[model samples]
Target: MSSTKRLLASIHDVSPRFEAQVDQLAGVLENHLGKGRFAMLVVPDHWGAAPLREAKAFQSRLRNWSDSGIEMFVHGWFHRDTGQHSGAANFKARHMTAGEGEFLGLEEATALRLMREGKALIEDIIGREVAGFIAPAWLYGKGSLAALGQAGFALAEDHWKVWKPGNDEVLAKGPVITWASRSAMRTASSLAFASLARTVLPHALDTVRIAVHPGDVSKPSLLSSIDATLGRFARSHRPARYAELS
Candidate 1:
């Protein structure tokens, strides 16, 4: 690990459906890192309900954020895992996430189409290129992995690392410290892990990745934990853009 440490922060599931919560999370991040210092993982359509194309007001907000130098990354299209899975994909689909791994079982062609469409949609809306494509829940199947390179995404991230999609090169290797508030068990575990990470990550890794979601705003405890975690890391790692890793 390098002597200097960097912190990469991002808010996932950015969409009109979670507009209010997204605002709250963004505020929290800004309080710690300042406006436009973090990235956003935007979902073009969340659960087939909230489509960015129809949300003109939110579109303006996205444009403003982009203009302010906040990097945007295209998250999964629907952010809902609907395809049937087998083997390891099946296990991940069932155990790793609650039907939110949108790209976990897609075929290469299907994944490619969604990736291209999402990239185009976000780029057109923001009037600039997105930083990368990160699948919802940080889960990708073999097909999605293949399609990622074909789609020409500059970067991508999984649970354990961030990498360049164009050349299959690993950029940063570290666990993304994130919170889960869907269920009590998940919330407790995530909180515990975040606490532990705050104590260990600053010394263990050269780059620390911390990600938050809209749902996290609903839980005050999660919000506090997020603040504490960010505060701890802010002391040891300089706030950094994902592009720096590339």
Candidate 2:
């Protein structure tokens, strides 16, 4: 497993900035996990107040890259505040969607209602159905399990990517291509290059997945770190996307 050679990246926050960064990350996935071997996490329905606009833009850019067939998973109904805050590792439980409407306090009926509406809206815009889901920050309340399964997701990458809500499990996992903060997008070009550097090192022999933030591309040092990481990883592993495994 340590010598594995695939890359699965999850993304959030769909915006014009998102559209730009996703392109660079897709390129990393392409170079490392070529030919139907990469995956992108999609917001599907998000915006903080903008709704599905960013999701649509992101989808459009991805569709353009479909010739390579990079796969996508519906990330979350709302990638914002469902009782969640940034600036911490514990975001695992707090992050959710505005559509999820006060997740900690809402009744299951309300939560399900918001999730369903978000799904329907995204599907309408994409002209197809979503196959998988990962909650924002991989955080979900107990009630979320049944509702998500009922919503029809075949695969999930939550809380360590272990197959779940179940009695059985699989090695379904991915990586976090993150940096010091959320303001990293200011240096996209440099960041992309830094990822290339990392892909070539001998140390990253495992099936690696790098998590990217819209902010990663903003800092020169951070961007350089990413490219360096990618370069280091690529020295030994063949680039692969998750859809190929499915």
Candidate 3:
């Protein structure tokens, strides 16, 4: 590992609905960093439907992961999109995530409520405090930001930067290298982006994030890219937890 660069390997959407996929991807990531070298963004109740409390087996797995050094962060409350969007946000919701912006247009109160509940539930279940909160699709509304601050969440992330809530302190700045396989165009573009980033990013940035979603396991190309990207970065950077960045 290079002393000048750091990497964050994150597994997204850890839920009962995506259990098998999550395990598979985790295994893949482990091959790169060993166990406990990554983080898991947990959805308390994915799509406001699949609640973690109901999945006893999955809860146990999460607890073990937590104990073994996998950092946990509360993701969106429901991991769904229920509000309308406009401007750049609208375009992002429509294109970037297919409308999975859970915190994009939430009211301050609503956002706070969900954030508090989700964080509390995750902490209770895992018997450890969650390190941060990241909204679904990396979209955070002004209200959501306000809510995060009021809720006393110390860390939060948007697409290009990681920041501390209440203080507006930036911890890192860089576009995350991630993949999307929801459609043909998205898959093609994502692979192109991954390839380009792998070739270009190490020269320009000190910190890089590789966020892996469960759906990525379904695509062979994505898995290959993930492996190559991780391998490439590992040669020149050290694995880091998000908390260490701050």
Per-model TM-score, in order, reads: 0.98, 0.67, 0.97
**Model 3: per-residue Cα lDDT over 1-246, one tens digit each:** 577688888999999989999999999888887889999999999986789989999999999999999999999878999898899878878877877899998999999999999899999999988989999999988899889888877689888999999799999999989999899889999999999998998888899999999989888999999999998887777888888877
Order of models, best lDDT first: 1, 3, 2
lDDT of 1 by residue, 50-163 (tens): 999999999999999999889999999999998898888889998888999999989999999999999999999999999999999999988999999999889999999999
In order, candidate lDDTs are 0.93, 0.53, 0.90
RMSD of 1: 1.4
Better of 2 and 3 by lDDT: 3
Clashes counted in candidate 1 amount to 0
Q: After superposition, how far is residue 158 of candidate 2 from its true place, in Å?
A: 2.3
Better of 2 and 3 by TM-score: 3
Candidate 1 residues lying further than 4 Å off, grouped into runs, are 1-3
Candidate 2 wrongly placed segments (more than 4 Å) = 1-5, 31-37, 53-59, 84-107, 127-131, 164-168, 173-177, 182-206, 244-246
